[model samples]
Target: MASKYRRGFDITRDSLRVFTREPSLLLLPALSFLAVGSAFAVLAAILFQQGLVESVVTNDLYKYGALFCAIAISSSVATFFNAAVVHCAAQLFEGNSTSVRDGLAAAWRARRQIAVWAVVAATLGTVLYILDEKFGVVGSLTRAVFNLAWALLTYFIVPVIVLDQRRKLRDQLRRSGSLFRETWGESVSATLGVSFIFLLVALPGVALGVAGYFILDGVLAVGALVGGGGIVVTAIVGSQTASAIVRTALYRYATTGEQVGPFDGRDPDTVFPEN
Candidate 1:
């Protein structure tokens, strides 16, 4: 267990280094968030103009349906951007120079696949949300478990969409599941390491926000809030980018049995070594 955690931390540290080398990669997630936020704002405005917002808020069926569509749209946008980042990270692993333009182009090329997967993911997410909202504690627990399982199973979906565009969506999902099974231990470790790093990164911002509530006044307090919020956002985006890069590296190592410099140097055989 100790060895596993060490390896996970090492992999995450290396992943962060790779991200720092190309801070531009973090722009993908930032852009995705911006685009999705803009879209949702526009959507809300339209709904309000149409006087459907009241219905959506009051009607259970309409509410869930609207939530479903919103979640689906957000998921699709996120998947598209994530696929782009995966493409760029894969290029980096291959020693090829890539920019945001290259990543966007790659994502555009795989847009259809991303759309298909997004619908599947959105459907599952909507169902889970509905279950948790409508049912009692048991339903909420089930949704939580299923949500984690879904995340674990689809860890490599972005890489598959970026690297194996020819495969059908179901096939890609199956491949992701298989690859994840082989590297579940490492994946968990990497996730934990990333989460820990994120916590560390956000701690100062959190402290500032708390201190602002007590010590600062008016404009200074608002400045603290904005500054702290910016740091938290940066940390979130950085951690997410690192996680995606690590996922891409793991997928390449698992599929090609080749080490890609500092990103991946583990033995292919050891990926699923004999017990």
Candidate 2:
């Protein structure tokens, strides 16, 4: 267990190094956040203006439709930018320089695939959302299990879409799953490693927030909470970027059987053997 975590830490650190070199890759996740946030805001406005928010809360049809639409919009936008990130990361791995435009162009070229996957994702997400909303703990547990499997299987979908020639959704799904299966250990460890590292980084801020709640009051307490919350939020964003880099590197290795950039010289089997 310690070894696995160490491998994850090393891989995550290397990915962060690559991220620092091309800091602009951070823009993709930031744009994804803004785009998804804007979409949700517009969706909320539409629902409230139409007085359908109450209907959504009461009527299953309204609720599902609203949820589906919201999921579709957010998923589409996020997946689009994710593809862009993967494209740029691929360029970096391939010994080529990249820019945001290059990434956007690659994603734009695969817009149709991204749209189809977004709809599929939104449908699944809506179903899971309804189940959790209506079925209580059982639904939540079921969704959690299903989501984990879905995440593992679809891990490389964006990379495949942007970096491979497969166009059909099923074809893309198969490719993603295949790549994941081949590198399941390192792939999972790398992602979990990124999360664990960020969690550690965020813990201090969380501790501050808790400490402030107990020991401080008024504006000072609020300020402490805000400061701590800011740290956590920043860590979350940084982890997203770092996670993207790791995914790109993993995808490149799984597909090409060669590690590039910071990932080079690391033997996958020795570093994080499959369990």
Best by lDDT: 2
With a 3 Å backbone cut-off (N, CA, C), the pairs that clash in candidate 1 are: none
User: Best candidate, TM-score-wise?
Assistant: 2
lDDT of each: 0.80, 0.84
Candidate 1 structure quality by residue, lDDT tens digits, 17-75: 76565778778999988888898999899898999988998998888888888988898
RMSD of 2: 2.7
Task: For residues 66-160, write the lDDT of model 2, one tens digit per residue.
Answer: 87898899889988998888888888777788888888888899999989988999999999988998999999999999999999999988888
Prediction 2 global C-alpha lDDT: 0.84
